[model samples]
Target: MKNAAVMHPKDRPEGSEHNECRALGQILDRVGDKWTIMVVGVLSRGPFRFNQLMREIGGVSHRMLTLTLRSLERDGLVSRTAYATIPPKVEYALTDAGRSLIEPLRILSNWAIEFRPVIEKARAEFDSRQV
Candidate 1:
């Protein structure tokens, strides 16, 4: 009988590793984007209107915010609600999957805060060498 611990290459689970890496890469690409991270951070504080998100996350343009929210909604990370009125009202909120990203983003924020000085120093050194 073949040893239980030592299976032939063909005996391994089919395409599991490749599929996992591909899926994880796609998720990381989305979450690692700067705009996505910032948008998700603000939305974690509950729903907000378009202008509110713009004010809260300064430096993001109206066009960019619209695109970002639309992408987020398409990805199922956020929900957009529109109210029918003389003046339209819209609000954005995080879905449960989006909420699940908050803790991880917080940890990444802490890491960035702690290492920022080190990174700055490294950047300065690299710049000085670029004569």
Candidate 2:
């Protein structure tokens, strides 16, 4: 199926596209990535600087964080604010629609926890079969 981003309504925000499949891919691209969801989950609390996001998300490389943030911003789920200063000031926060994702993420979290054993078993089986 086409990604929702590409087929989304024409009235969508500037950074957002109008194709349904493109939009779907954009969403999956954001949440399906381990780091993007974590970033959004953490940012749901409030805005944070890039370094702060890195600290909060943990184990994420600077490049990956940058990529994730850029993609999220492009998808209209996250916004970037910049301030002029000696070193420059920047922060990331969720848009209202991005905020709406928190509840669904919570549900996904619950599902991950509940099905972890099954998932792990399947993972191990698949890994072993590949050997």
Highest TM-score: which candidate? 1
C-alpha TM-scores of all predictions: 0.79, 0.74
Cα error of candidate 2 at position 100, Å: 0.9
Off by over 4 Å in 1: 1-20
lDDT of 1 by residue, 44-109 (tens): 999999999999999998998898899889889999999998699999999999999999999999
**lDDT, residue 81, candidate 1:** 94
> What is the Å distance of residue 15 in model 1 from its true position?
7.0
Please give the distance, in angstroms, between residue 55's alpha carbon in candidate 1 and its true position after superposition: 1.3
The lDDT of each candidate is 0.90, 0.87
Give the lowest summed-lDDT range of ten residues in model 1: 1-10
Q: What local lDDT score does residue 19 receive in model 2, on the 0 to 100 scale?
A: 50
Model 2 C-alpha lDDT per residue in residues 1-131, reported as the tens digit of each score: 45534555654665555355586886687677898789988999999999999998899999999999998998888999999997999989999988989999999999999999999999999999999
Worst 10 residues of 2 by lDDT: 11-20
